[model samples]
Target: MVKAGRVLALLLLLLSFGVTAPTATADAAPVLSSVWTGTWETAPSGTAPALPGAAIRNVVHTSVGGTAVRIRLSNRFGTVPLTLGAVTVALRRAGGGPAAVAGSMRVATFSGAESVNLPPGWDVLTDPVSLAVPAAADLLVTVFTPADSGPATYHRTALQTSYVAAQGEQRAADEDGTAYSAKIHYWYYVTGVDVRGTAAGSVVAFGDSLTDGNGSTTDANHRWPDRLAERLQGRRLGVLNAGLAGNRLLRDGVGPSALARLDADALSRAGVRALIVLEGINDIKGSPEASDPVAFVEAYREIVTRAHALGIRVVGATLTPYGGYSAFTAAREAVRQKVNALIRTGGVFDAVVDLDAVVRDPASPERIRPDYDPGDHLHFNDAGMRVLADAVEPAVVG
Candidate 1:
């Protein structure tokens, strides 16, 4: 009887561990309801230098918050394998700085290890860390590379400043802001940051320079999508800006063509419920194929079909007029009109946001309103961005 009792106690202990282990794994799994993604665009050629051992800090604003967070690092454009020495995440104390708020710092690891290696053309995610992040708040991510890390993968047009330590310096693991003094207007390696929650899914704004905030004030978060995020504050939906400046719809230009990158930039995101497409202007200005609206329309239709396959609704925004821009021509203008007519005629999109109607001059029809044009006649001014954001119907997004 004594031996049997001991055996029974051991069996119960094993069961407890087994049951609790699965529960812990379940808790640590990614939350499928809500996601806040900070997308990465291409950095101009030769923008990032090789790191022989340095610490780099990037500041990214979160559109939603939750109890746990994970970060993505990439070597998508690197020709050589990239080695990450260490990584850390902390809440920023102020605007575009390296400082983290006191007591809010957390160490991030990859699969229980402190370091990771990313092969050329790949991305990796850090193990989730328990942290309370607030919506629209900024977080500082610091990375250290110990080896002669080859050409860096980066995104220019961040509009927000990021910092890098001098070559061979190892201050990246420091928790304080004093060590980072150099500044650059781009993000390196870091791709997306995600938080776990039960909020309504995310909204991805996919477009070209117009949607990328080419003319908006830097660091002001005044991009139309930024304004839309501000308006959607406290709601379950978060907005992700996937606009790549100079990106096109038909063929590759500054970055991969919109059709080529759609799966990675929009569909691969966690918990995405809707997407707002504002492409084709670049194609109209540059591509020979744009002279015929059929290719552009087919590209958009493919996007809609693929998105719907993933349960994501598509919102189509009419191409804003660019009549006075240097690239504008009467032929391109006719194509633009045809595309806009198709967008308004329905069937391709779940909803329509008439940015053309909102920003175009009512009298001229083919030109941007004077107040909305920021000298370029293509991109919107700050107030114009606000108007574009306000034009989005909230009821249709979720």
Candidate 2:
């Protein structure tokens, strides 16, 4: 009875001082409903001459849906500042001529400002904008540059054609896209798009031309990663394609070396949970080829080590056959076989997907299956891309 009286007295004293007692649930903070995850991404493979005063509409495909979206733009190779007069994002119209769906466009901002500048070597993500993003849907990210900028960082083989307005035109806000009559094969400035939603995470497909969809139809989205995205639609995990055509593992070719760009293109991407590395073929065939199996194995081990440090599961894919490629030689073939043998036994990855085994012709073990080859032995056709996606172990990514 005395202890109860003391508790009452304390409460009364607090009331007298005008400090109300806190309620258990009411005083607690509200929980956030969604987390950010990467839905689509592309690495900048090289630089291009700037399009002064032009508005560019980059068409990107999504791997997952979300209530809101954000974009990443890079000037990682620029020589001067990238002045963005305005940036906007919208769902591509049904018929799609760079036009946006009505009432779906949203202006993007940085630090709450509609306009911002990115200097050389700069990489930034736009502030999130509310929009109903759907899986497999196309988005048109429009950027208007009111003045001349530096060499524009670009992904040379987007496989998807985007649009660009005439110089000195500011059509980023134009809904009809009539001003965006000119088309470009490259994805300029933009690098990635992240969505805020209930996603498990994302898988990064990091590699070279084989992964970059070099032989896939333009705007068809038939890249292996794109096919993988379709397979992962209901899994709530985004698939990011970090491939660069002609890219090498040991040295730069179409883009920075695999090791050099891994961090920016795969490791540090939004909500990365797994990594699919399909590189090394270029290194084995390109000039100053890294033919030594030891060198290649060491590089693969290094990749595994780096990815494991961040708790990312790494899946190593054996190099696909390229027998009929102009660059093929007996010595190179031996090196490829040696590397694949080591990769199958190295124990350097969390998992392994034998792309060579799946795509190689049984009759000519060193060559790709004819049905899968897209005339170029080094690249795959749409059907082959589907095979690559199906080869991945779903449990590994999950």
Candidate 3:
């Protein structure tokens, strides 16, 4: 028989690893909605240095307006305790960078405290700060680390530049951009932002690099989902982009597979009422078993069934042509055709978005339109991204 001492030690070990019992926040009043969510992924350690006694400013755009806002910070990939010294939120100056609009900044607290400690594999939601967050405008979330925090947790390939302070400088409360001279493309330690408002709900764009805006202009917010948010400005809906570059549907790569992270990335957001799936091209080109429509279809069906259970509507997008890519092959092209055909008529989702019909070249029918191809032949250009966004029906999202 196992000793009582051994049992106690085992329980301690599990608790150290962040295993804890669930608690209820149901009695909490004032419901808020998440207007922007960037799914967190472990940043390759050593690729970017940790912020020791420095401030990092992450610039994110909101999809809807609100009177109060809160930020979510994560240490999911850290190997040590993450200590935060100060946190602030403010409206970004028109041109971007770390600048905040004068007199618009507000201090964010955790559980009524100015600072908080986050254990490894854990995240914290800040107490709501009253700020007039405008729809489709940029917000800067600034964080200061007081000690030599180990390797940072970041989302690689943010596609928009963010600012970090030089060593020996703590600029989390700075209202100007001069204190922040260094810039990086990855967003560190921030996972999401929630707003208190009357928005109907959020729409999550779940997919791979195509949906992540690989070739779109930097700091332009021209990603298809961003354009879709712009199109949905006057409405009571929010568009949250959950795309991870090089993601797959059947197996894990850059991030967890769609099937694995669906619950956390797509369904966990605040007020999510719909999901748009546009993945599987990476699986077609990367995984041997994924070349068949059967496996891809099965995964899609599972995603639909799970979303439907939560009363969330699901929309499947037809995979676009990728003929000129280096890894393209006749077999993979055939698989794409079969999968697109299924998405168009399989009735696996509540509705369908015919992306293939909107962006394919008429002459070849198997290649992206010449003007839409951004030299990669796989991802779309800015104009193409807008076209893809324009094709999404507002009525369907509502």
Candidate 4:
């Protein structure tokens, strides 16, 4: 009787453990809802507008369906007061068709001043506007400028390929005379956009220029990260691109350094799950101070540790090849190789994306394939960007 009682107790305990274990697994970690990052520009390349000055304008097209949309604008590089005037968000038809005026537009205006001044080195998020967006719908976000504020940073997004109307070009506004036309290049400093969905979490892509789509075709909306978002379609995973051009893992260059910006860019974001970190090339080649392989490894370790403490999963990407650029040198190449070796072998990262192995030319081994290398060999062309995006394992990301 004693033996039978003990057996029955053990069976009950095992059943309880099974039920509780699966519950813990189901709530493993928070998932992302949506994510995006880019820059806003005052004018298209080649044309210079007046300063103090000219009103810089661009548009954001979104197909993300939600009731509330949030816009994140940056003055991270601005030295003077930056005022944003006549901010409006609207929906457009496929292939840059006419805007959905009447009931489809929402104007985001400042309560007091026509424009909001952004102090240098700081960024601000607008209040969430209540708007209904449809799936795969294009949104046109227009900014009317009265003078040149500063360097306008923008993130370029358009269905298919399109162009941003240059300055002085007359664009028709709605009955309110607020919206205007401008050239588009998908690369903008505006940074992030989060769509409030029925889900509970979001994702952040922590990367550098490649992830920022340095050489991808402008207004085409073909950045690898963008492609990844399209793949998620309706999973309700929020994806935010925290990529900056000329950014590094250990030091600052084009924008705030990765480690320095992590808090505001990733940790501070609501309901963040996994972090896709595809940086370090700039650290290997563009470090203004000095390049030490050992020091680079230590910095990476610290980044991983900090992220893990926040319950975020870190996925490390091996630095891509840069063998033929003007900046390339045997010494720099050796440093890059060492860093890649550490990223692959080191157990710090939760997972690894072997971008180097995926993009490197078998013939040269140290150089990117001609087909994939944009003229400079340092950045990937659109096709190369696709390859890099495909290299990412969806299972690990989810």
**By TM-score, who's the top model here?**
2
Query: Residues 41-109, candidate 3, lDDT per residue (tens digit)?
Result: 222211245778888898888888778887877766677878888889999998767899999988898
Error of 4 at 297 (Å): 2.1
Which clashing pairs does model 2 show? Answer: none
Q: Which run of 10 residues does model 2 get worst, by summed lDDT? A: 21-30
My TM-score estimates for the predictions, one after another, are 0.88, 0.91, 0.89, 0.75
- What's model 3's TM-score? 0.89
Residue ranges of candidate 1 with Cα displaced over 4 Å: 1-47, 167-170, 287-289
Better of 1 and 3 by lDDT: 3
Clashes of each: 0, 0, 0, 43
Ranked by lDDT from best down, the candidates are: 2, 3, 1, 4
Each candidate: RMSD to true structure? 8.9, 11.6, 4.3, 13.8
Worst 10 residues of 4 by lDDT: 38-47
Instruction: Give the per-residue lDDT digits (tens) of candidate 2, residues 1-398.
Output: 56998988865653342222111111112129777888999989889988888899999999998999988888888888788888899999987679899999899988677887775776767777999999999999988888878788888999888999885355787888888889998998888899988988899999998888988788889999999998888788899999998898888888789988888888887788899999999888889887799988888888889888878899989988999999998899999999988888888888889999999999998898999998978899998999999999788786
On a 0 to 100 scale, what is the lDDT of residue 201 in model 1? 63
Better of 1 and 4 by TM-score: 1
